[model samples]
Target: MAAIDVVVPNYNYGKYLRTCVESVLNQADVAIRVLIIDNASTDDSRDIAHSLAQDERVELILRESNAGTHASFNEGIDWAQNDYFLLLFSDDFLVPGALKRATDIMEQNSAIAFCYGRDVAVHGDDPVPIMPGRTSPVAFRLHKSRAFIESFCRRAVFQIPGSSVVVRTEVQKRAGHYRTTLPHSDDYEIWLRLAMLGPVAELDAVQVGLRTHDSNRSREFAARQLEHILHTAAAAESFFNHEGGSLEDCGALRRLARQGVVGRAYWSGIAHLLRGDMEAMRLLGFAIRSSPVSAVVPPVSYLMSRPDLAGRISSFFANSARSRHIVF
Candidate 1:
């Protein structure tokens, strides 16, 4: 059996540390090791990590300072001596059969870059359930190398759950480690890079428990939506540059990417408007720049709703849209 190293990067998640570590420890019939990298957590995480390290299967890396999750991932990757790697957050846990299922697929087909599965999102303090379904309904579904990448370009959202993914260590190193610069979109960018290199495998059922809490990056992204929009657009641009094509194809692909960005901004702007957030105007401005004709209608309708601000409408539109046209 190929060794599977599961790195649990934790920061102030001491309460849930045991549940997360035990889940990895309990994964059946695989040569698995758990690395608990506590990022100078102020809570009881260090104590819990020390306890977990007593088990021969578990290793601990207690950082002196919180260098952030990306840094933890890089350090963990360097420490991994296994064939496969999983960067599991301390708050999330794996389903019982996840490791065995992922390992079998990777062992059989060496070409697969990574294998990912859907996760059951557990909100707040809910207990992680024993996922009831076929572990391997079919031999894993193989995604064509660039198929997922092109799909992401056309539709600006990453569907894979980060914790549920098992990546080939060699491929992960070759693709490059997570970019510490992109706090919210590092996983999105790395996944794109991996997809570009080789085919990805998709397990049919849920294999991970994704816990949603206030500290989750998704929540943070929602509060500062413009950042999310910009990060996604930057990732798309990177993909477009790296996946070169003929001039016409490149032009067409660029337009499609822009359309995807504009669509996301359009919908997200409407959501902001419904909530009466002033950021709606900024997002709408982004949309308008990307697709001028389509983006103008929503903002115009919004302005019509607020007759008192009629005088400032034109000026607001002019100034907000003045920034270089970023597709959402």
Candidate 2:
């Protein structure tokens, strides 16, 4: 059996699919199976996928019509049959030896259900840079289920990059499929569920190259902050509304997450208001709707009180990537 089963869900990203598939096909020190699931692409993606399927390690699932991302994600989850599984978007590629590094940590720590590392973004039409894994290996940072949620979800901030995360096959199977309703933040929501299963391993290394282009999903959401807020909120709701709420301190965690989202939203709103830009008022509106109590406290007062948050909102919203980076 292969060490890992990588599911590459492609749309019309023909230019990037081959590079993404080949990245895993070319990985050394680990055996991986690649499944290129094309969701009725209209571009040259089908041909490109067929050509890549020539490799014995690669297979194709060409859907006649588009069934949506969650469909592909769920299909991949159902098809995974290896020790490890990764749902890699067609726009991302792993660096050399990334699989081995991540798998090694999970193997050593039986308590860990998944592992993730850093990922650098490459712009359009560019090749994934040659990163031969991290030169100086750092110790793996392990976060218990609730602890990981506290560090990330409490602030409605996302730290894990989807491409960088590698999960245990059985654990992923148990975590269940990606939800269709959370189209924008399904990745975020799935990470939350997986963390609920066991401790998460954070490896200190750049493991994947996440390509950015006009058609990229994260870029689209960054341009629509209002919709993005709702999507992320839906993810949190999905998690707590399920059995995940049984975790210790679930109520406190939920309250803190709401406060964090509401607080930062107000701060973002204040920044935009200072510039006389009403477009960002969506942040304030969302904050008010999410938590009336938190929304009443002036954003500046919140920032002043928590000195640590002084420049977070300003810099986060300064650019699309940074803005999308905060509430993954």
What's the residue-level lDDT of 178 in candidate 2?
88
Please, what are the lDDT tens digits per residue for candidate 1 over residues 103-129? 788788898899998888898878888
Model 1 misplaced regions, further than 4 Å = 132-134, 137-139, 239-252, 271-279, 296-328
Q: Which candidate is the best by TM-score?
A: 2
Residue 121 C-alpha lDDT in model 2: 83
lDDT (Cα, 0-100) at 148 in candidate 2: 79
The estimated TM-scores of all candidates read: 0.83, 0.89
Q: What is the C-alpha lDDT of each candidate?
A: 0.77, 0.80
Candidate 2: residue 167 lDDT (0-100) = 96
Error of 2 at 107 (Å): 0.8
TM-score of 1: 0.83
Question: Residue by residue across 1-328, what tens digits does model 2's lDDT show?
Answer: 2399999999999999888998898877788899989999999999999899889989899999999888899999999999999989998999888888888788787778899999888998786676755543457888888887876555565767789889999999999988887878888788888988899998888889888898997877776666766677778878888856887878887776666666667766665665566755788887887777655566443354443463665555676443343332
